[model samples]
Target: MNAASQSLSHSSLAYRPDVDGLRAVAIISVVLYHAFPFLLPGGFVGVDVFFVISGFLISSIIFKELEVGRFSFADFYRRRIRRIFPALILVLCVCYAIGWFTLMATDFKMLGKHLAGGMGFAQNIVLYREAGYFDTASELKPLLHLWSLGVEEQFYILFPVIAWGVWRWRGALLPVVLGLGVISFVAGVQKLPSNASAAFYVPQYRFWEILAGSLVAYWSVFHPVAVTRLRQCTALREALALLGFVLMGIALFVIHEARSFPGYWALLPVAGASLLIAAGAESRLNRVLLASRLMVWVGLISYPLYLWHWVVITYIRIIGADALTIVSGTVAIVLSVLLAFLTYRFVELPFRRARSSLPKTAILVSLGAMVAAVGMLSFIKSGLPFRPGLADKVKARETYAQYFENSLPEWAYFSRAGIFDAYRMECDFFDLESYRAGHKSEEPRARIDAGCYVPDTATKVMIWGDSHAQQFYYGLRQVLPDSVSILQVASSGCAANFPGRAQDGKAYCDRSNQFALEVIDKEQPAVLVIAQAYGHDSINSFVELARTARRAGVKRVIVVGPVPHYEPFLYQIVIRKHWNDTPRRIKDNLIQTFSELDERLERKYSDGAGGFEYLSAMRHFCNGEGCLIYLGDDRRTGLVTYDYGHLTPPASLDFAEQALGPRVMANLELQ
Candidate 1:
């Protein structure tokens, strides 16, 4: 150990306003990014910046405390509990209270599960297993930000022990720790492709970011000579500080969610934060740029600001407000600021102070009381905390029994293939482990009607793709004659490219594609009909798949567009239960968003080739301004989808009859 460095203690350390200023920059960028993603595509980098700042500040304090021989795990945990848990618990309480009044049973159920994850400090791992942050369906979960907190807590639990271990060993700990950080960074970079969620969420990959700050802390305390020598050149310090800010600004503007994140690209923000921290209070740029009184003030309340902004934006989106709109975004910020100020004044400051307004016993008791209150609220959400009648009323009643029994499969609703299940879904097709896990197929079933595959007499029409393609079965059965055959096979999560390595599970898709090619070569079927989900974003992949099919001797490939996925899942439940809000006459605002995807797709591939055709139900599904919801004469008997995207059996049948029947018959020359 460095004896001279051991002399420095927590008593000698002072709070750095400049660090708070850095925090202000991070929080504002994240808030702005979430509030208006287009304004700053890289605004999400703010979270990375905050992680670095957290590592630096916390490491500095820990180093100081350990040097003074006063470090205590109990004190550390108590401080953390006091600092983080109360406001989080408060937010959950208020959010659930709102859910009680406004949200439906299914949403409440989801919130309850997420609340449990949040309280347990494993939300990141939970969400990661569920498929990471950018999954379209994930935006609805309110506590998604808690994932970052989970990552931070994981760091907090492990880093102190490592630091203490190194201190006791009296060896080259700094170099050893830096080597560990380097290894983590390399591992993180390598793991980005297949397991992005793990790369994004797990501490192993993120440790380098935190350690970057820890390394700085080590330098400041044990290598003060370095800082002093660097500071002697004011111009160089100013230049480095300016470069740090610019780098952070570039990352916030240039980076995007579509790209893999927190990998090698993350070095920009970490290095930027490190530079600003290294320059410290002495650098003219940091003093003015980061430590400005306004910046310090915002930084002082940044934690609360971060907590409240997401909730505010989420509530706005839930109420059917445009999250990206200027007016709603402004309102969201105003509300977040107001709530943060209130929580900062009423909850954070008092709890953080050594001489709190409440007696220690009273404070601890209040925390217990608060926890009990939240527990009861959570139980209420689990199904009516104390009300037996309400519990029975809110339960998943038998009204949807027909939908469950005939309309939705247990596999459709709750299997790993189902929406609710999240296990064993991403295996490689050719891997023995994956084939055992069902990514591979044992055999290919012929998708022909009445076991007919006779030439000239029998023309088989095959359907291929994901669940979206699976949805076409109901529609196709209605249009095709009893004389001709129809074949359909789909698996969830498989893209058009069949895995050559893991061959078992993809047999369905491969056979369907192969069947179309064989029919073309054999000239048994008149038409080769194929359709898939195509959007502007998917145009390149869609074109490539279609080109491959065409080359395989398929006469034509069709592209189907995506359906609009709603935010709060209950909107459909309410519409189905009470009123008719069919896609034909959807709200104008929603139509605009739904149409955006279609318009972009149509523009890209409208003129591809004879190899491609666009089969659109847009005219039937939507009018010029909006789309229909259900397609029946009466409100009580219309057929649509049980959920937002998948079609109901009857509705799917009708859609097939209307859209693909003529094409299929013509393709087969069976009319």
Candidate 2:
């Protein structure tokens, strides 16, 4: 037999270039999934490929040493530190340096927190809680790929103890590993559907893939002769390897991001990797493909490649002008490969080649501690928002701080957009709808301690509709002169001109609209303003509501068009294009229908042909550059619409100055 086949056919845990080829497959799969998800949606299963490799290799080492009665935890860890820390520390420091320049304030703050998690090998824990709706997009997180490393490291730390403690008998360890693997696999399958994030991130749910490898390692060490004889059968070896490849192919094509992952789906990659490993180099498939020179080279540097690939792609996306496309992603991948080669050569090789000594381990540990300290300090200082050179980059984030709370464990957008309570205060009713659920005893909630309507003894403008209308109170109060006092009476739902058929507690909406009419009649406001989130065909209803106001003895009626809106939120735009970039295509993400609606309304009604003033909120806020994401040149004016389409205090004030004030100026005689 050839030397290559001789080395691989034994289960002695000798060097195997074919295994490195497997590493190449794993790393490439993960990179492809991250860089171009559409191309290989299930490529993420490559991480399971890695788990099996780690389990077999590490278990082989531990079992060999324990058999000889010479195993030491110190020796095991010193080796682990040398293997894992060099590339890790290098990647982290580079990320820190580059992140300082490119990342916005909130993004940087999150980067800091992730750095802390990665350093502690608790990235899986960090990631599990980070799957909420309001958090930054997962693609923008540079250290996100580290969760797999964190999982591997945790297993390496814990599994060796289990192996050594259970090594009393010649065959004792197999059942323990097998039983644990069964429990982990079953429990993970049960948990995946309901708590997908936890199943994906948690080690307990993941350890089964590794233990499958341990089972292979156990069989190999105990039955090396039998394994060698099995590999010597060319037809059987070819069949086993072919089946492994087929399973992996099915996994890559069939599984996807939408799948409840790492459940039954995990068996494919695990079984595939195990069969390929057991098939040995003698198989034509293993010898010709996996042991090829190119595959071996990529496998040699796969660890660093995995580390570099995602960060490169993510950083480019964080700052790139347009959305990430295949071309840009290809560029990112090429750069990652180059960086990986450099890291593998300069950073990883030197440390790995050195003798495993206490001082060597100590130096690596110290470097890690220093890097962790930098991460911790950055996190404690809130990503150093005060960093000297970053002010220009950070100003946009600070201007919209309420919309970008990066420090919290979960994100809820617009939670601090500004006084939401004021809109519901004493008028807006949400609890009234829940009476259908038999909460009749639950007192309907409306923050009515504060008067629903703004009090004005003389001429005043009253705004009425729903929370969309009421939110205008802050901005109008701030911008309009004190003489032009305003009234805001609204409900949580749409307000009608008159009552509709009421059921359950839905009567509250009609009552709220009636209350607005009552306030309008009692106060006898000179100008009655109607505002709400307008639907496509609601203009007729609005005109009817306008006629209702006129009948209530209103001197003049102003209809406020819908405010500009954004989807998800506005910060996504900030991550891609800073508001200052000329030709930034801020128009891309804006809901175009609102701007069109505003233009159409202004053209149809500015001539007073509709019998009242129609103030286009979109006209004052939107232009050729698209609806304003934030107001003012430096954007210290804050977000125009704090949430999806409700104006902030500053925006409302701006609206009053730009739209309402001009319409009212001639009549009110305000300079």
lDDT of each: 0.61, 0.72
Highest lDDT: give the candidate number: 2
User: Which residue ranges in model 1 land beyond 4 Å of their true spot?
Assistant: 1-12, 132-136, 321-324, 354-458, 482-489, 498-543, 564-584, 589-597, 600-610, 633-639, 642-644
lDDT of 1 by residue, 324-406 (tens): 48998988888898897888778876765557465554465366456545544653444232333334433433223222221
Candidate 2 residue-wise lDDT at 518:
80
lDDT per residue (tens digit) for residues 202-269 in model 2: 88999998888888888887788999999889889999999998898888889997666889988998
Give candidate 1's root-mean-square deviation (CA, Å).
Answer: 6.7
Q: Top model by TM-score, which number?
A: 1
In candidate 2 the C-alpha lDDT for residue 184 amounts to: 92
Q: RMSD to native for every prediction?
A: 6.7, 10.8
- lDDT of model 1 at position 286: 76
Error (Å) of candidate 2 at residue 62 is: 1.0
